[model samples]
Target: MGGLIFIFVQVLVAVFLCINFMLITTFFTKEFFYTTMRYILFAVTLLSDCVILIVTNLLIICNYLKITMNLWLCAIMFILSTVYSSVTPFTLTAMTLERYVAICMPLRHGDLCSTRCSLHCILLIHGLSSIHFIVDLSIYFASTSIKFYKQSMICNVWIFILYRWQDHLRNAIKTLYFLFMCITIVFSYVRIMKAARAASGEDRKSTWKGLKTVILHAFQLLLCLIQLWCPLIESAVLQTNVKAYINLRYVNYIIFYVASRCLSPLIYGLRDEKFFCAMKSYLLCGFYKKKNVI
Candidate 1:
């Protein structure tokens, strides 16, 4: 029964990821590149999600087949999961910062949000997100034995997650990384919203629009962050209570995968009419007339 359900969820997740891929592909088309930096970061998030989704589906299929994954593959799965988890908040912070400048510091928004600046922001974020993971990964594999992991055929990132707590280096890195990313995201949004609230006469209309967009983006990020932490939460729960059902771990994975991949694009990406129109155009394969972006 568990295997059947896993298979079912895998099918659904794969389908949703395909839709996400299509939508993100549309984002790179000529029309969508007008706002280059914003779209680039958007594409990065979508691509990062694709990485996680593909790996997740592969892992699920392997489990259903009872094929054991070697330590390397398992490590790759865990690393990719951490990578996606980190990139999420980093990208979100950058986006919020972008919006903050657009609303709160409109005079300098052009320079701050330029293509070059956005690219620099992306590089910096990727660096910050990966440095601690690199250290954690090194320390983890150095001292820990993976013989059991290779034999278990679990094929899930959560496996590595549960063990990391035992290694002080990994434990510290994980704790600090999550805390810092969460702080940055929350702080950026708070600042952005505060700026929106203080807008006056000439900028009121624009401020209101920016505020709405930021709220929608914040909602999406909040959901993603919650999903990212579910595994950790599950691990903590299992540690404290022997009575906790083991199945809830998979429950968290499926819910997180679906919510982050499927709902995010639908909820936040749709706000941009041009992008939505582009998505429709891509899906219809040119048969539909492109709407004018007046």
Candidate 2:
């Protein structure tokens, strides 16, 4: 059963990674996508999601194989996973804000969301995401002896928990981080919705589209936030029934983690008519060229 679950996870990860990779390649190949703030942000989200999927699944594979490594190595993997996992929501919030500006404050959108500004936002998102990891590392180093770092341990985030208070602190910080992101997205959605109602014709259609994108962002954020609770949920199930806990664990990982990451590609890569056309062209290179020639 464990092997079956591992295979299932690997397949899901491969499928999403391939889709995201193609979208990212499309973004880079098209010069116009690089200049557009929305597409730039979407690309960043895709890249971040890819990293998260890879790192998390690598850890899962290690666990399934009962692989143990030095404490420091495990910490590095765990921290990478945590940091990138945080990046998706931050990127999503930025994407929502971009949509908000585009729809609600159209005249100022160009000035506010320039290519340079988008790049800076991407940098800021990563820097901000690393803050939690930095804090956790600090606490970990302060709590543990140097010798402890040399010992072998299973590569799990829980291994970093030197004390009960540390876990509580991590949860508290996560709550605050997600709360801020949720508020930003909600504010964006509400403002965009109002703009949609106030506009007409093409502008109204655009505003409505932006509103729907924000809604998708909100849903993605909800999924990311729910992942933080999965361990607790699993623990509860474990106390009741081990078999049920095992099944619930796989379900939560797939639904919250894997499925959430899938949303970025669906929302931008496939749903956006312009991006979809470009992506399709790249994905069907020979066929597209032949059709175009004919």
TM-score for all predictions?
0.78, 0.94
- Candidate 2 local Cα displacement, residue 288, angstroms: 6.7
Model 2 C-alpha RMSD vs. true structure (Å) is 2.4
What lDDT does each candidate get? 0.68, 0.87
Ten contiguous residues minimizing lDDT sum, candidate 1: 285-294
lDDT of 2 by residue, 1-294 (tens): 856887998999999999888888899878999999989888888888888888888888877788988887888787888888888899899989988888878799989999999989988988988887788788889987899888997888877777888777888888998999999988998888888898999989888888888899999999989987988888899999988886787788899999999999889987899999998787799677889999
* Ten contiguous residues minimizing lDDT sum, candidate 2: 158-167
Candidate 2 has an lDDT of 0.87
For model 1, name the residue pairs that clash.
none
Error of 1 at 187 (Å): 4.0
Q: Superposing all C-alpha atoms, what RMSD in Å does each candidate have to the true structure?
A: 4.8, 2.4
lDDT by residue for model 1 (1-294), tens: 566677678778778788777777787776546466666777777777788778777776786677887777787777786677667657765776677777777799888888888788878878876765576566666767767545645666545443544445545665676567567656766776676677778676666666666666666566665664665677688888644534565677677666655655764468666678778767776554454332
